[model samples]
Target chain A: MTDVKALAQERQQMFVNVYRGKIPTRIPINSILSLEACIEYAGANQAEVLWDMTKAEPIFEKVNTDFPADTPAGGTRRYPSFYQILGSRPFVMSSEGVMQHPNVQGMEPEDYDDFIAAPYDTMIEKIYPRLYTELDTDPNTKALILAKAMRAHGDEFALLAQIGARMRAKFGFASIPSSATTAPFDFLADFLRSFTGICSDIRRYPDKVIAACEALTPILIKKGKLPVPSKIGVTSIPLHMGPYLRTKDFEKFYWPSLKKQVEVLTEMGINVSLFVEHDFMRFLDHLSELPENTILRFEYGDPKLVSEKLGSKFIISGFYPVMLLHTGTKEQCIDKAKELIDILAPGGRYIFNTDKGAMDMHGNITENLKAVIEFVREYGKYDNPDEPYDLSKDPMPPAEKIVAEIEANLNSKYYQTWEQYRANHPELEGRPQEVIAKKIKKLEDDMFNFIINLGS
Target chain B: MDRLLLLTQAISDLDEEKVFQILDELIAENPSDEEVQEIVAACQRGMIIVGELFDSDDYYVADLIFAGELMSKAVEVLKPIICSRKKDTIGTIVLGTVKGDLHDIGKNIFKGMAETEGFEVHDLGIDVEPDVFVAKVKQIEPQIVAMSAVLTIALNSMKNTVDALKKAGLREKVKIIIGGNPVTEDSCKRIGADAFTTIAGEGVDICKKWIVNSIA
Candidate 1:
């Protein structure tokens, strides 16, 4: 009989190999599907199956069967698969056992006021009660209930309980990846508050805003306790407040709160991983204060610049654009993968992945996965190639220079000439500038911050 | 000349040490409603700039969140004073995330923005049940009902909430508006909703237009 421990060890070895810039037998694929796709597959409407786990399970099982891979034998195991987990809402799915929502819903202050005015502790407080009341009665029912509830709405629940004992058994001590925490501002804007409200709040109630941040830390810390895998440290996705505010605003509202979270998480020995989603081309310096071995995930960020700035200090993942899977042909995907591998793989602290998940609309997933696998097989070997790649030698111009260029161009004679040229044409009157000079300037500043921080 | 511009720049800079100082100066100087409006407009411009920055990867999520917090603070300070004389009611809205979901970031943001856009919003927070949603509509007598949910599982909760409202004879009284990451136009229709938007900004616009068309 095959040795289970050996196989598990082998899988870990392969993962480490890829992480260490060595080619593995095959690239690992971790594909995530949302509940929408599962609903579509089940031929159900949104309402009929959302509340009932039993109703959504058949479709989930079918999808899993269609895309079969051996369930990991002994590490942290996620039961009911990702699909079942995502589909476990308390509301019933549509008659066809599929998920769908025709109207998007949002709340205002009045809505919250009305809710708080009412008796219930809101929906979050009712989880345990509902689960105990509605779940089936069987010896194994507790485990099933836990699994079903987690599958449905577990992101907020205690993490350890969500991952059943069977699943928890698969992990080794210190084997899981670290958790990443977002700056309070990013957490609220991206997850809690609306972008517009947050921007306005910064000016109106800075103290209240800071107080809110301080208040949330305990809640987040409490939530963080549920998911600390023994071997793998907690890593959070710190999606910085980008595309919403200026750098100075970031320095004030964002950094202070994030620095606090990082301090707490680091002090607890958890790893901080950041997904710098927007232009960090200039903001890397702010991140320099973070402890060493902090994991960095750069999306749409220049890899050359990231390596130059923070490469030696952190474990970096990603730079590949997920959109490439949908837009690029197989050959193009392969070429791009090779290019990334050539540039990012030479260093020991890189892992290959797209900047973000392959979104639902993305196509040619298999081809893209194949491209990544093929590139790793062909070029990821640790054996020194005839021509060693050196990232330090090819430095890009400072981000400030780029920003300056853009600022200069915004007021350049050509732009003025164009405005004058178009002024006579009534058809073009009141039209906004076609060239996004202001946007470029912002990008330049952000990038410059990122680059300058690389040296720090 | 550009009081609004100056205020907005100060807010964006987030000079905490100097924020209160500048705000004190502005309040003491007693800027006119027009001046306040201009500053509000500047803040709006800053939001658009921030949005563009986010879209173009010029700013990070943290920057947007920080700036948003600052902007919200500034607006709060001016809002009470700006509308002291006027009792303008654009419309009333009842909003909540459907039952079995605890995510409220999207809902809270929408609530704040809706208020800014001149709507009286009743925010129900997260995991609201269908019957409760209907009860709120009847009690509040809102002209519009907005629902939000971030999880796919809660999609049914949204539909059920609408269905319950329709059954309770309250659906015709309100324009049902839905917004969230998982929600789309098709989903809105399938769930028997009148409208849907992906972001809070669009939700405000949808609510505003819906009220206008209803009145028309």
Candidate 2:
């Protein structure tokens, strides 16, 4: 009889082969499931599961037991309960089972110099007080929070290890990818600057931004180099704030620290897979400048265009618009999966995941997601993953008409908003000032001038 | 340059010193209500350009933020005089980030822009529950109910707020606009919001156009 370890090794080898740029026997699918979503699936109350380890263990084990056997094991973010124990409220509990992040500004703009001087220390000293306010003023309070956090981490690690072993024994799936931290640039962009802060800093204090991004690099390099390939072949760093920058700003302020972290990780034989957020169409030209053989999971880009450009250099995955899982028919989802496979599966080195991933059940229509994954698993066989494949069995709906109809409906809503506004307010009844139009044109000119120093 | 033009350019340059200088000049003249209105419009013109630069990706999010700060500061200089008289307002807006969401960069920027456009703004801060919003609506009787949320999960809370208002029989009494990263026109319809905007400046414009059209 085959040993379960042998069966687990069999699945592990398939992931290893695919990561090595081989097509493998068939394409592997990632569940990309959030823990909250997993908990919800098992009919557990999310509130109870967050803070209670005993309640959480059974639910997580059940979730692991229920995950489709074919899905490659992956990691989830740190538990909200652990963070709550640390006296940090980074995420507030949404009405849904999941938690939503609050905009927590860790670093003040004035603290840039202090942060640049000692990155880790600054985060602990200056940033933590702001983020975890309860731990700010009282030494005893901080110590208590620290004690709780330590206890929580110990419990969590033990629980996870047990669940992982069970999952491997039961389903031949051991979490293959090592969890890692982001590059310093991302740490600043996500943890410190937040979205609005960094975007402003790029222009307002461009040099300071550069120095701060670089300051985080040594720390990032340290974290990025923590794992050996034998432990986990790939280190996942979800990319943020990169696509939002203008191409020039990316070259100047964002890319250097990121490039260094990836280089360090690569020299150590740990491959880096970037789950690219938003669109990176603007930065496609700069792909060759970075380390090659990297994995890119794009969120909202055109897959065909990505394949056309960086497909040869990077192992590309994703751009399967997850929104379709909710909005489109099941057949459309299948058609889309086939369309992406046809575009990206050629010449090897592609894995398909949800565009932005399905965080919870509501993230995508349940049946639609399952059908697409099952179809891709079966149809994405190496023997005929490519086209001149027949799509006659399920053809796409008229794309233009659907788009036009959606647009028309959205357009009518705008008019309706205005009409309703007028009806709601019976006080004033007059046209918009004619002088305001000229002011608008002048404002546009001034704005154009300020941006990119247009005339210069 | 004319005082109005100088005011616009000062704001465009984001030179707070110059803006204050010009604002003092305009106020020293004890400008008429209509002139004060023109001065406000001039400053708004500059602020609008700053917003446009942000939209076209010419200026950064940081620039939009600085511009908003500049507009807010400039508005404060004019607020006493403007409010001292019986001035015209586009309308009142009750705005907040919904429960369980604390993202307010977009909301804060929208608040500055809405105020500059002469809307009386009441901000309830982040993580506001449905009852708080309902209470604000009942208290202020605002013409527009603006909600902002960045998380997709918060969309459920936004919908809940709408449901609460409907149950309270106050849904039709005000206009609801949802704005933030996770919201879309589809989500707007799903949540029973009259409209949605991801852009802060555009949200301000929507308020102005909606109120203007209402009166017209």
Candidate 3:
């Protein structure tokens, strides 16, 4: 058996090297498979495992032992108990046991003005109830269900974390502490307005859509930043709706807020990894405007074009079609890896991954997937892995603009601000006031994140 | 430009207000059934331009969606006249988003465009099981069976649907076309679909060609 400890250390170092804009010994494989895929692959009943997440321990153990990748085995994608307790309309488990997020509109088209006026507050008051049926009840019942839902979420997360940690330790998977956030516009389009609704509102109420995104910018930033910031661990933001918009509409509605969130998170030393969905080829120039070393995993785009355009300024991964893994022979799959590595791995800032994450058991042929990963490991080495690269050439947006925006929007009407606290407790002066204010702020921030996370 | 040409341009532009204004004016003029048919055809031609622009990347999926909305709104203004005309239906299509997939955006877009283009679309709605699709086909005996799915797992469901149709002896009766995020050339062949598309406009165009070929 390989020295699991040394392998884990080496993988971590390689990822750190890449995050800092340096080439590693080989292209790091960060392939992600969905929870359904793991459970089904482990020969467990997916529905049963989803209901009792502890059943997934053996599944992850088997998968981590068998799968060849640099990244660790991920826990459950969404805590089923969390959504199940809340009776979440937008995200519900399908009959097949896989969680499906169908399009749902929590906010109506006419509610745009209200949503824009006070984004998070409106989400709590109007949208949350519509999305989570349990939360739509009277005050006492709503509070009780909300608490129960939170408890369920906590229990599931704790159990999964334990399983995830055990797998990493036993199997020597790289410890990449990451957080997830949605793009501001995607948060709006996904939960508040449905995909169809947002698309319609972009034409019908363009200004309001833009305003809602702007209002969401600060909250999304708070949601995106890691608890303890790291240079290597990324906050993955799955971008949606950009490719569906015209350049003019993208610029107006999507880009500004997203660009702000990325810049702010980047400035905070939190690496931003974007799962760029669909064809974002036209917006390549716009993406180039983001901070240096932002990891972009393209779902659909010409890899050559992406490499030629943004290779020097950013870390590029993805564009290996997962469908090929499902249908192609092992040789064909390896040939694709070679093609993408030749184009993207030439520069130091490339990671080998699939265009999109595997969704279910049908997403990949197991032998083909294993062979492709092994082939990438052998074939993806660099001749000069440690060559010096300068990221300062491509400048990120100034921090002052982002800080100002965040500060302006940080205090919400739904939560008590420090100023409000200061006004309320006039007797407590100086240090006492400051200490209480800090604790209050932390609690408020946590509550805000909890609310916003429910939407995404 | 003539009023018909103006209407075409407005629809193509997705200028909903202008499309409605011109439509309202035509309704006031009490246009004949043939003239109304000509107007509807004009609007569809404009929608074809929208599709072309979408293919060229000048427009987008959102534009296609808005164009569908624009087409429907224009049709609404012309509905009274359209009902009076009693035109021959070009074809019939049974459409749904397939089993275990609740996404209806793509399917709905195709249904709207196909309806405007004069196909009698029996929308079976989202998460439609194989038996539902089979039963719909048996009931309607439509010329086309369109299955849509955004999830990859739904691909198997689509295959199951095709197999179900074949088992029911309805496979040869209708041409199968699959649309959504997951369908590719390989998956289309795997699912035993006759055709596949990710774009609604393209899907409608394919259905139109299928009908035209069948009629010939």
Best by lDDT: 3
Task: Tell me which of candidates 1 and 3 scores higher on TM-score.
Answer: 3
Q: What tens digits encode model 2's per-residue C-alpha lDDT throughout A1-456?
A: 456667666556556655656555566666655666666666778767765645666665665455453553333445566567656655456555455565556778999998777655566567767766666877887777756765565566567666666666666674464636576676786657666667657656778988987876655544443322243357677787776665777788778888877776665556688888888888787755667778888888778888988887778887887778867899899999898889997766777787876555674466786677679878877873322222234333232233223223322221222334446656535756345444543443232212101000
Measured on C-alpha atoms, candidate 1 has an lDDT of 0.55
lDDT of 3 by residue, B119-206 (tens): 9999998788899998889889999999999888889999999999999999999999999987899889989999999888789889
- In the range A1-456, model 3's lDDT, one tens digit per residue, is 469898887777788779888888788988567787788788888779888988888887777667778876546557678798898999887767777788898998877777777777788888999999999989999998888887787677678778878877887777766778889999999978888778778877888888888878887887776644334468899998998899998999899999989988888766799999888999999999999999999988799899999999999988988888887888899889888888999867999888887766564478888888788889987778884334345454343355435645654577766677677887777667667877887766667667777998
Where does model 1 sit among the CAPRI classes?
A: incorrect
What is candidate 2's fraction of native contacts? Answer: 0.40
TM-score of 2: 0.81
Question: Ranking under lDDT, best-scoring first?
Answer: 3, 2, 1
Residue pairs of candidate 3 with colliding backbone atoms: none
Off-target runs (Cα >4 Å) in candidate 3 are A229-232, A387-408, A417-443, B84-87, B212-216
RMSD in order of candidates: 20.3, 19.0, 3.6
Best prediction by DockQ: 3
